[model samples]
Target: MNKKLQFLVLGVVLILAILFFSVKWAFRPASKSVEKEKADFTMEASALAGEFEIDEQKANVMYLDKVIQVKGIIDNISDEKTVISVTLKDPESLSGVICSFDKSSLTITQLTPGEKITVKGICTGYLLDVVLSKCALVE
Candidate 1:
């Protein structure tokens, strides 16, 4: 093959290889459930929120993207189409921890405000409230 044709063929091959691997990684199966994975930190929801409120940078360094198991009373539960967001907080506190669960994995009908529950999830970060994503109820 001429040098120009050889270079073109090599570039096409590289592009195809890149696209193949990208698609494979994008559609890979989900990771293990938070319920099955061991939590890196376990604490009350109020305490987790307090940590973030006191020092957001420090809390982010310690808890961001880490698996945490938090126990607290359900302050509110909102069921969306794909996710069910459960807010856990002390009644008197303005800040709280929000745990989001996959709607298909949890049955929120039995859960109600004021009921205490434990949840395990990955801490995304803190906004006004500490956010936990990919959460699962800890029985």
Candidate 2:
């Protein structure tokens, strides 16, 4: 084959390869639910918040991106359009562990403030509050 024709064919093959992988990645199946995954760490909600409050960098290394199960009294609950966030903390403390769930995944009608519950989620990080995402109530 001619050199020009060979180069054109190679370029088209590269483009097609890139497009194939892109589409495959874009349509990949969603990850398993947090409820189904095993927890990497489990502790009280106040203790988790205290860890972040004590030393954020150390806490991040130990907890960030890890699946955790935390038990505490519900301090607050908010139902946004697509997400439900439950704050767990001690009655006297200002900071808390904020656990977020997909609205469709949880039956929030059964949850209320001042109630004790266990939740499993992936710890994202800390601001004023320790944040957990993809959370589900643990029965």
**Candidate 2 wrong stretches, greater than 4 Å:** 1-27
Please, what is the whole-model Cα lDDT of each candidate in the order they appear?
A: 0.92, 0.91
Question: Model 2: how far is 46 from its true place, Å?
Answer: 0.3
Alpha-carbon deviation at 75 in model 1, angstroms: 0.4
Native RMSD of candidate 2 (Å): 4.9
- Please provide the root mean square deviation of candidate 1 (C-alpha atoms, Å): 5.3
Q: Report clash pairs, candidate 2.
A: none
Lowest summed lDDT window (length 10), candidate 1: 29-38
What are the per-residue Cα lDDT tens digits for candidate 2 across 1-139?
Answer: 6999999999999999999999999999865349789999999999999989999999999998999999999999999988999999998776999999988678789898999999999999999899999998896
TM-score of candidate 1 relative to the true fold: 0.79
TM-score against truth, every candidate: 0.79, 0.79
Off by over 4 Å in 1: 1-27
